[model samples]
Target: MIKYIEKLVKKLKTSEKGQGMVEYALIIAFVAAIAIVALNNGLGQAVKDAFTGASNMVTSASNAAGTWATHKDT
Candidate 1:
C-alpha cells in the first residue's frame, strides 16, 4: 500500500498536463479572497455610494434638460 501511494505521488509530481488548470484555480481563489476582504472592509459600500451618486446626478441633469426644452417651446 505504501509503495502504491509513493508511485502515485511520484506520478503527480511529474505530470504537467493539468498544471494550467491548477494555476487558474489558484488565481480565482486569490481574487475571491480579495473580493471578500474588500467587501468586509466597506469597499463594497463605497462603490455602491459612488454609483448611486453618479446616477442621481445623471437624473437631475436629464430633468433639467427636459425643463429647459419645455420652456424654450413655450
Candidate 2:
C-alpha cells in the first residue's frame, strides 16, 4: 500500500494534463477580454443611442399622461 501511494504521488507530480488545461483557460480568458474591449469600442455608441431613444419615449409618455390627467379633471 505504501508503494502504491508513493507511485500515485509521483504520477500526480509529473502530470502535464493540468498545465494544458491551464493554458487553454488562459487563452479563453484572453479572447473574452478582447471581445469585451471590442464591444466597448465598437458598440458603445449604439448602446448610448438606444438609451437616448428610450429616454425620449419615456418623456413623451409622461407628457401624454400629464395632458390626459389635466384634461380629465376639467
Candidate 3:
C-alpha cells in the first residue's frame, strides 16, 4: 500500500499538463479574495450609494420635465 501511494505521488510530481491550470486557478482565487475584502470594507456601500443617487437624480429630472410638458400652455 505504501509503495502504491509513493508511486502515485511520484507520478503527480512528474506531471506538467495541469501546471498552467493550477496557476490560473490560483490567480482567480487571489482576485476573488481581493474583491471580497474590498466589498466588505465600505466599497460595496459606496457603489450602492452612487447608483442610488444617480437614480434619484434621474427620477427628479423626469418628473420635472413631465410637469413642464403638461403645464406648458398654462
Alpha-carbon runs more than 4 Å astray in model 3: 1-14
Q: 33-60, model 1: which lDDT tens digit per residue?
A: 9999999999999999999999999999
All models: lDDT? 0.98, 0.93, 0.98
Clash pairs for candidate 2: none
Give the 10-residue window scoring lowest on summed lDDT in candidate 2.
38-47
Alpha-carbon RMSD, each predicted model: 2.2, 5.5, 2.7
Per-prediction TM-score to the true structure, in the order listed? 0.84, 0.53, 0.71
Which of candidates 2 and 3 is the stronger one according to TM-score? 3
lDDT of 3 by residue, 12-68 (tens): 899898899999999999999999999999999999999999999999999999999
**After superposing candidate 2, which stretches have Cα over 4 Å from the reference?**
1-35
Prediction 1 global C-alpha lDDT: 0.98
* Cα error, candidate 1, residue 68 (Å): 0.5
lDDT of 2: 0.93
- Give me the overall lDDT of model 3: 0.98
In model 3, where is the ten-residue run with the lowest total lDDT? Answer: 65-74
